[model samples]
Target: MRYVKLPKENIYEFLGRLKEYGTLYAPVKISEKFYDFREVDDVKKVEFHYNRTIMPPKKFFFLPREKLFEFSISKAEYKETIENVEPFVLFGLHACDIFGLKILDTVYLDEFPDKYYKVRREKGIIIGISCMPDEYCFCNLRETDFADDGFDLFLHELPDGWLVRVGTPIGHRIVDKNIKLFEEVTTQDVCNFRDLEKKRAEAFKYHEDWGNLRYLLELEMEHPIWNEQSELCLACGNCNTTCPTCRCYEVQDIPSLDGDTGYRERRWDSCQLRSHGLVAGNHNFRPTKKDRFMNRYLCKNSYNEKLGMSFCVGCGRCTYFCPAGISFVENLRRIMGIEDKSCPSEISEEIPKRGFAYASDVRGEDI
Candidate 1:
């Protein structure tokens, strides 16, 4: 690792130099308490201290809404249209958000490769920042406090300025090109940097023990807490929208103004929507709100285990955006029966249904 110092005042010059690579994106203050990633021409617009953005940076690569194909109505035929995405750099990304991107990489590039997503992801560079956790954050529980890989370069805030660490060969090239911007690291600098990170970790306190989350979710299939919480759920989908790891979407076709030609589009979809699981002939598998709610937890905790990582980064964005004030941590505790010790005593000798009470409904409801 190399140590570099960019005078707080000269940070703008660094960004200006990076613009030659491609368009640059950094956090910008959009409103009183909302920040977002936007095109950056002026380095002053970069808000490095932002706790979190209203939406994750994933939208840059896999847009929330995008055109997937174009169709000709006359022939009733379609042709796939690949987007030629330009190379770019993502700056000021937090560790939790980086983990989110890794999840997307696995889903889109490994399982079933998405050409559009892969093209964009391969062309971009990731520059991550170590952000101090806010009151609502629990990234440590998900073991995303610090990313060892997945980033080209990582920056840690220092009292004098910023300490930059190169994580990949590509990262080293950038630093070497601007060798004048950095200085050799000494034993004292390393000690100071490690000490700073140690102190920062203390500020983040785990709300609940997440080490046993997999075990808890395995045994809580029949818990009644899901039913109670579903009553207050508005199904607004704010949680999914704000969540960095949620990847569900739907495809649609839009006709041109003349109705001769049209383009197929893919828009972000939510599992909370009643029609999400609907099939032909109006067959809905998960009709009840409680069933859908339970699926979110199971997918995040249980299903993700098979994928080699937990889907939840513990960013707490879901709890922060829930209109009904439903806390994910609280729900996890309920599912584990940690709040009620007597729940284990009620376990039956015979295992009940596999939590498929609504399987009879083939036609899903509309959102």
Candidate 2:
């Protein structure tokens, strides 16, 4: 609820001051039309006005590949070895990613706690900025586009400068500790924030919503679109790897050739993989690519409903990264009988998958 003003001209000065609090990691431009979160000392390297990052902040917290423990080859002994992490601040996050972090928290910390992820959450601070949406984004329709919590500080972009909303004690300390870098918020500042919120909500290019989809998706289990879309699915798992909410990973234990010592590691896994549903003795439960593809939708739409959240969050990262050109929204629209721009004029006809026009605002494909 607290508001403060940051002049665009002095924004770098503000970023530089944050290093006084901890090591800083913000969105840095990797190339034209590509950005990623990286450690930075120079504030000028940060870029906020981006459509999206190649990956989300989960890369840092959850870790794509991490050592879970070490074990002896000779004995039945093992010890947990989660890494000890240091305090740091992640700046320039988009609101959807911030909410994405919240969904991660719900998965790891709520019922069966993940000690490693919980520790990372406690050690890190989240600072997000307002972002514009492309056709691939629908976080707005699911109401995950804007964040009120899950962030230490949320910045609203404006024509003049930035309006910041402080959300936690750590965020307050950042402002209070560097009082000289920020100025008092005026009445006009509040109006600007309001204007930006209204503008952001209306900015999303894809907003076809079909109400609570938990039951709708369950009833759609036998829908024919699943069979047709599976033809276009490559099952590469780019969707799960790039998605902020797809929390699936596989654990492995690697033993030394000499049989002296071994270590257990956990790496990110994708349900779309052929081995994802494979069991002992080589029996795969979800055998077909279509079964795997439909499972992703069911898990997002129905399984997480009782958690009081629509798991998709409508980030649209899945469709953007799919090599086979599967658009979740477009596919969902097909199942729900809603008209989609990507669909053919004949609803019964199969959708022609998109080309590798990944960067095109309208043409869709996954990263």
Candidate 3:
């Protein structure tokens, strides 16, 4: 890992040069309090201090709606419709969002891989940035507040400039090609970086005893909290749409007027929706709101034993945008019979042995 300083004045120049690699997509302010990842037409439009984007960068890899393939009924010919797959760079991604992409990689790039997702993932370059936690942020508990990998280059904000960490060979190449734009890291810069980490850790307002979450979730499978949250849940699916890690999708075949030629399409789906579990003969696997609601959370906590992690990256998007006023942290406290605790700069180091493993255990550490 290499560290360097990027003067704030040269940020725009650096951003412009990054376009040489691919199309640059960064967080752009859409409204007074909302931000979204859009094409960086002008460097001035990018928002660095933004809390979170309305949608995660996962959209660039796994599109919301895409044509899988087109087929001819008469001739029985088929062709995969994956075009305009040019290389692209995702700039200013937060640590949690990058972890979300890693989760998607596990699902799409392992076992049976999705060719379309693989193509996009291969061409994508991830440049992460550091961020302070807001009231709704709890990635610290999930051990995703800081990322050690899964990014090409990561930038941490400093007073005089930004501290850049090169994580990959491509990241090293980017820094090497633009060596003039950066300065060597100094001793004070290193101390400031350590202080910044402490500041960010203390900034989180949402704290919880998450060590027992996995075990409690399994022990209380029939807990009343599920039923309680179900009544408030509108089945809106907003949480699923905004979540960086939610990957549920539905495939449909669109036919022409002749009913001979059509293309198969895949669009984002939500477990919160009633139609998600509906099948032929109208047999719904999850018929009630309680069942559907419970399924989503359970799916979030489901352990990926191969990867030694769960689906939730603790980005807080689901809780931040939930229309039903669902509080993820509070609900977890409710389940574990734990109460609200003030931010202490550190969470428990103990690891749970059941249900799901902590994010820090991604290297296969003993749970």
Candidate 4:
């Protein structure tokens, strides 16, 4: 690991230098107490200190809406056009958002590989920022506090300046090119960084332990708590849309004005929607809100066991964006029976072994 220190005043210069590569996206204050990642031309607009963005940075790779292909027909002949993605840099990403991107990598890259996604991801670079933990955050509970060996570069706040830790060779190249913006890190700097992380750990206590998650989700399928919790659920799908790890999608065929040519497009879908599981024969796998609610928990805790990673990155985007004030951490605590202040078993008997070689091949049945 390599470390560099950048003076706070020169931070914007560093960002401006980074803009030479491509579009630089960072968190910008959109309104009162709300921040969102957008293309940055002025580095001063980047809000690196925010608790979390209203939405995760997943849209840059997997767009909310994209044209998969465009086709034209002439005399019963059809031709298709595919768009090429451009390279860009994602700046000021939090650790939880980084974990979310890693989840997307496993999903889109492991499966029948999404070419569009792969192209966008390959062209992009991640610059993660270590942010102050908020009350809604429980990433440590999911064991995703650190950089997770994913980001190109990770930054930590310091008293005098910023501690830059380069994770990949690409990051090292950037550092080498912008050597003027950074100075050699000392042993004291490393110690100070570690101490800061330790303080952060103590400050943010885990709402629920990782070991209790399996058991908590196992027998809670039929619990009346779900009905009570989902009573005010608008099913607006805002939570799923904002969630970085939610990758459900729907495909549709759009015909040209001539009605002879069309292309299939895949857009992000939400499991919370009633039509998410609809079939051609008018059959829906999960018709009730309760079933959909339970399915999300199962996917996050039980079904994702095969991947050896929980689907929820603990970014708190779902909880933050929920209109009904439903809190995932709160629900998790209730499910684990932790409100009574009793320690639960470390391991659950229902915890399944990792299965399948690829995430795509691993199905709920396998779990």
Highest-lDDT candidate: 3
RMSD of 4: 6.6
Any idea what lDDT model 4 has?
Answer: 0.78
TM-score winner among the candidates? 3
lDDT of 1 by residue, 134-162 (tens): 77788887888788878888888776667
Give the Å shift of residue 49 in candidate 3: 0.6
lDDT of 3 by residue, 62-155 (tens): 9999998999999999898887799999999999999889888888999899999999988988999999888888888777788889999999
Ranking the candidates on TM-score from highest down gives: 3, 2, 4, 1
Model 1 score (lDDT): 0.78
* Model 3: CA > 4 A from native: 340-367
* Per-model tally of clashing residue pairs: 7, 5, 0, 0
Note the Cα lDDT for every prediction shown: 0.78, 0.79, 0.85, 0.78
Pairs with backbone N, CA or C atoms under 3 Å apart (clashes), candidate 1: 282-363, 283-362, 283-363, 283-364, 284-362, 284-363, 284-364
State which candidate, 2 or 3, has the greater lDDT: 3
lDDT score for residue 198 of model 2: 85
